[model samples]
Target: MSLPPPALRALQGLGAVWTAPNTLIGVLGGLAGMLAGARPYWSRRDCALVFREYPWGPGGAITLGNVILHTGASLEIPCRTYAHQAGHCTEPVIGLHDHERAHVYQYLVLGPFYLPVYLLCGGVSARNPFERAADLYALHGHGWWPLKKR
Candidate 1:
């Protein structure tokens, strides 16, 4: 896996630390994504340890805030049809790539705090400027979710 740019790395690191309060939760959420994604490679990678966060009861559902999966998000979602954050993400649909990629930049720019800001901004249903930009950044036609669509 190639690493992000130095500046982005630094920013994300800082965001992780600064937002440690919430990032702790995010870490747990992200861990879920990682685990599911690693399933096919776990034994091969010699991966050890099980990471799961059952917030409610023994039969409680997984809790993956912004971490979108193929089936759905961590919560009780019907069908999230969008690829999003953390370690693993479902493949992007026709219009969700640029939207989610812009969110990755938000993580770089704001780090952990992005989560709260996202929440305050209404999350998936948000109409905030940041969310708007991400949602519309590359709705036309795109490849990599860079500033300029390819």
Candidate 2:
């Protein structure tokens, strides 16, 4: 059921175009982070640009589309300190890069609606379907999309 190579490439190209607005925002945010001493690096595994050691925000990491700004040395480290402090770290730690990459894919699918829909889904809360889906993908390497019930 997977798309053929040419079809997949076309679809991906369309997705990039569709998500360009959000990616622009991500680029702006990345630039700001860079000003704060964050170093940029391309992650082949995540297929996104990462700004490590970002000095602002509430801490940990934030994904603005194809960019991830994180307050850490590397994305391999666990970024969910709040989860651990709240005693909700029962599951294995999920890679921060992978979690943010899920958001990139979400942007590709949702395009201009991604930000509004993300806010409607409860922002950063654990109860948010977007966050849940990201965690699911990070933990299991699939299920990045939040499917609606029929």
Candidate 3:
């Protein structure tokens, strides 16, 4: 059989997409959520939008929602729940805004490997180093969020 066209071969590479797991998931999930009556829009905070409500998860699921971001203040994807949305301005996160943002950076740094790294650290509320960093950002300084509340 003749080899597939160059364009087709290139696009097929997406099947192994690992440069940004969250981003990949976000794009696909966001599209699906959008079609499922959920609206995907960007937030004023420069985050990706996917009019889904990614709450804290059920059955004590720890963290919830689906948001992916690598470098800047942009979030990708949105789940059928509250992924990463606050108001018309920020993500739905309040006390943990900084923490969540840290994860976004992790995605950026780790790219497609972020998911595996995060999982190795601790799936949900396991106090993994990555999570620690985010928590620190919110509780500590130099890159914290809440600022220890004095």
Local distance difference test, each candidate? 0.40, 0.79, 0.43
Give each model's clash number. 1, 0, 14
Consecutive 10-residue window with the lowest summed lDDT within model 2? 77-86
Candidate 3 lDDT over 55-135, as tens digits, reads 222421121123422222223322211222312223333334445655554554456666776687666542456654565
TM-score between model 3 and native: 0.50
How well does each candidate superpose onto the true structure, as a TM-score? 0.41, 0.85, 0.50
Mind giving the per-residue lDDT tens digits that candidate 2 earns over 54-137? 888877788776778888888887655224435766677787877888888898789889999999988878767888788878
Query: Which one wins on lDDT?
Result: 2
Specify the highest-TM-score model's number: 2
Against the true structure, candidate 1 has what lDDT? 0.40
Please give the RMSD to the true structure for each candidate, in Å: 9.8, 2.7, 12.8
Selected candidate, larger TM-score, 1 vs 2: 2
For model 1, name the residue pairs that clash: 64-74
**Residue 19 accuracy (lDDT) in model 1:** 44
